[model samples]
Target: MVKHTKKAVLLTLLTVNMIVVSACSTANTSNQSSAAPTNDAKATAGATGEKVTLTYGGWKLDTITEVIKAFQASHPNIEVKAENTPYKQYFTKLETSAQGGTMPDVLLMNGPNFIKYADNGMLKDITGNIKADQLDLNNFPASLVSLYSLNGKNYGIPKDYDTIGLWYNKKLFDEKGVAYPDASWDWNKLVEAAKKLTDTSKGIYGFAAPMMNQEDYYNTILQAGGNVISDDHKKSGYDQPEAIEGLKFLTDLIQVHKVSPTLAQMTETAPADMFTSGKLAMYFDGSWAAFTINQNQDMKNNADVAVLPKGKKQGVVIHGLGNVISANTKHPKEAWEFVKFLASKEAAEIAAKQGGAIPAYKGSETAWLSAFPQYHAKAFIDMTAYASPYPVSKNTSVWNTYETDILKNAWTGEKSVADAAKELGAKMNQALAAEK
Candidate 1:
């Protein structure tokens, strides 16, 4: 899920504080314009056995520590230093590093921020490298490949992908005598089950309706046959009736159905915390959350996953992270070699076995599903049949900020769904216009 408020603020800071290199700029953007590394550059890099140290930046470095160790073992000529930062402060720190011309040689790029960096000539156009190496783009999901691409040029290689699913507690369902959610379940069934399962007296809510985007409202919006942005990526869809209907679905759970905790209540205790603590009977989360959810001993035997209940139709949001090389890197060839390994089947297999996230590599999901036998983990992959890419644009954070601020009104009942969504559409349109 996109943490709209914090990330949006950092993105704005990045655009303001860092030097914005034009896509066509020749001064500091030579890396961006270069089609491929010169043969001499490659000869002096890892291929020639020259020792090189490259900084790799990302949040949650612990998750890929094993992968990094494996890369170092295979490529003894290159040493990768891990620069770990919390996700909350990741972009802020990246911006600071970019300003100092100390950006990591290789870094993680999420869908929302990928275009921004590419547009500013901060990321190397890896199209030439990919073609030179004959790395099959077909090895990953098309959505992810496109996510990190701009104008027929690829800038990043997918590391992994995540899709949303409905996570529920079997113990709670059994106690309430509610049947487990399944593929056939729809909006009405979810509401009925939630009503039966809710027990305010016991401080347990039947469902979690937090003010979240990717994990909550975004899926609902898509399920209602609505969209967050237009197909052309130039307009907002929030003002559409279908979009309003989707937002209303979640708000009604809190306001009309009273089966969910209010936004304020959820603020006091995060819905994920509630789920792990057995206070929330049902919640929606991403496939990346599998490890964290299973970490709770109490939930190990009590929880399982299912496809999200359909609204007007079945839908879910799909997103992934990619490994991008910095345009200012001193070791372009070495960085590409490391990035190649990161996107290779070996790395994907390690990721699957280690269980940080679902590997985006085509044929590696079986290992991931086998990694966790406690829950029906396949439900995460199953939803990909109807999953839509998480909405993005060059300035996704600007409109995301508008979404976070404006949608709070509807979630709080301060404004009607129609009013909040309509207002948000107008604000988002202004931001979209500025992108031009």
Candidate 2:
């Protein structure tokens, strides 16, 4: 999960400004010639005792001040300068830097945009770096490591991971005389509870059916035995019956059941805001929002999380950011050094204790769970048993445009879900075909 502050903005950017990066080869090793550093590359680029400065670009740099200070204390020869851009503008800034040949030495990269940057010859191939240093790839979740890998070559070190969970307000449930959700809950139970909890007179909704993907519909699609992209990555699954059924479930909540906030209502105020304000009984969001949501005085004592309700089967989407080196960086060795430390247990521990996103480093999650003792945060980790990778393609940005444009009608109740899904599938298919 990119920071929650950037979710709506990033979603818009994906449809608007995300363009095909370059006409470069799509091979996993395409960047090796110019971007990958040789095995015998020196540890430092300058004189034996000189220092190297690395520019680290990411959203919310202030969250990791302690980690950066600790990194420099250990690697005294490397000075890290953080380039903190607001989450909404971070990717746009990165694109400008890549186009102008001034990408930061080290930067944070997300799963959806990873293939675009890797295929366009903008990111360093770090497979050799991992091999030469013998960094244990096992430290991170295999799914995340694979997400950052292209064809068998690793390009990034996964920094952290996040999964979606059901966030319910205990006070609201108690007030409505509704039982709290749990692992045993299924789609039928969720609907029954939602109907009971909804109160139109109080402007209170039972659930939130936003037009978002990762945090909302994608999980349901998987649970309904559907895929967003096909196994071979060449076709769209939106036109399939399973996918349409999954989508219709949410649309019906707004149009027929009248238990959820409409797209327009959620647009005026985010679902997360409604949840914290005690105007919603149940909401779905990523683990990345835990800390920020807990900051609400009322919610801090009244809310907790549970596994998402099962549909045909249980499923959730997993996504995370990785740290990658810029192909154009003059200091590959120093950049790799900085990246390696960022993936280390020490740094992961710092992030976990701060209640940041879930650390990808194995065994480090305990600290993160301890940071939020009031809630059942471990439900997020438990969901990993049935988690699916966030969907992507070589030209994901192209198809992303199709999803937003075609699906908005279904979300607004202006078009039937079946019709909207079918249109989206056809357009997405054409976009995927263009990548070949």
Candidate 3:
């Protein structure tokens, strides 16, 4: 079942500090020039043969291109200009745009950043628009819808969702004469398999246990019955015994058992790169990795996935990106039309067949599963039965900074897991408490 939060109180918790500029300012004059008709004027303008152009911004350039082409084919009067930004700089660009009142008419937002944007009055309240358009919310999971909502108003429509899985090198498993991981395998089973598969001489480790939150330790923490943040979003759970156990599990794989590469080794080669290069036997990764793996001829043939091995119980962290609109957009009607179309069954089918990630729309997963028939694609969808929402407080980015810096000590063995976790908890609590 998906969790829910009461409407977030509008708080002055801005993740990015920028000088606020009004929409009418000189900085946004160019933005205002591109404004199309208002919702009520849209139909009349269309009848008079007016053309509307919308600037759409996102990190998924390739996928967005395909989606835009499909959208424009049917709605010939609407033109969409794609603004692609690399993920590393995407948020920085977006915040800058928001500050200048030059944000895109339609923008893509991920779960953690959605609340930050919505609470800051940067996103449109699309509840009335959605109701007026009669777009079916039933197509998406309630939990997913909840993720894009704040204080009972919808700010975005979910585009895709992801869950973590154990991606393994099938050739390595066959060479080692070990059975591939299955539903029956637990944490102990995974460790035993990793030990058998590790080859120090070949510089190949059994696994890649990078200090990542979503794809690595978070699942273990949830499976171990630990929370990242309290249900009320008022406290941190890093210091909890189960949460610490989860962190230690991954750290031990590097520092003690040596079944995974150390932090220094991974710095030389990223875990994903190592896995793709056939230097790692097993890696915990997200469903989105399917597209990357499938693109690589060598890894595509050898890689397969399994449900994440059970910890104390089966668990995986789930998150997705949503399509949002700028609150200051002049073409509310055209923007809503585009967003509604993107959330429709037609768009979901196109995305599913692209094999980038699973569409959040219900019943569209079959296409995604069929996109790569050789791999165990069903494992990702099936694991959703025990998936946990990606943990976030109102000030997620602030606390996330604390998570990475403080947890690195434990990951690198500079500090004991208990000590590092205790410190992380204290700092994280301070960040959460600062949020309204």
C-alpha lDDT score of every prediction, in listed order: 0.83, 0.81, 0.79
Candidate 2 C-alpha lDDT tens digits along 214-277: 8888988988999898866789999999999889988888998999998999999999999999
Pairs in steric clash, model 3: 7-151
Candidate 1 stretches with Cα past 4 Å from truth are: 1-47
**Candidate 2 has which clashing residue pairs, if any?**
none
Top model number, lDDT? 1
Give per-model TM-scores: 0.89, 0.89, 0.87
The candidates, ranked best first by lDDT, are 1, 2, 3
- RMSD (Å) per prediction: 6.0, 6.6, 6.2
Clashing pairs in 1: none
lDDT of 1 by residue, 6-118 (tens): 34444454656332110000113322235334442655556666789989998777888889999999989999999998787777777776655678889987877777778
The total of clashing pairs for model 1 equals 0
Using TM-score as the measure, name the better of candidate 2 and candidate 3.
Answer: 2
Clashes of each: 0, 0, 1
Local error of candidate 2 at residue 266 (angstroms): 2.1
lDDT of 3 by residue, 1-436 (tens): 1111211222223324322110000013223324423344445444466888888888766764677889999988889998988777777777666546677888888777776667756677899888887888988866678778888899999888888889999999999998999999898999999999999999888998998888898888988889898766789999899999989999999998899999888878889999999989998998888878999999898999999988888888888778998776767777888999989888888877765468888888998888778899889888866677677666687877888899999989999999999999999888887776
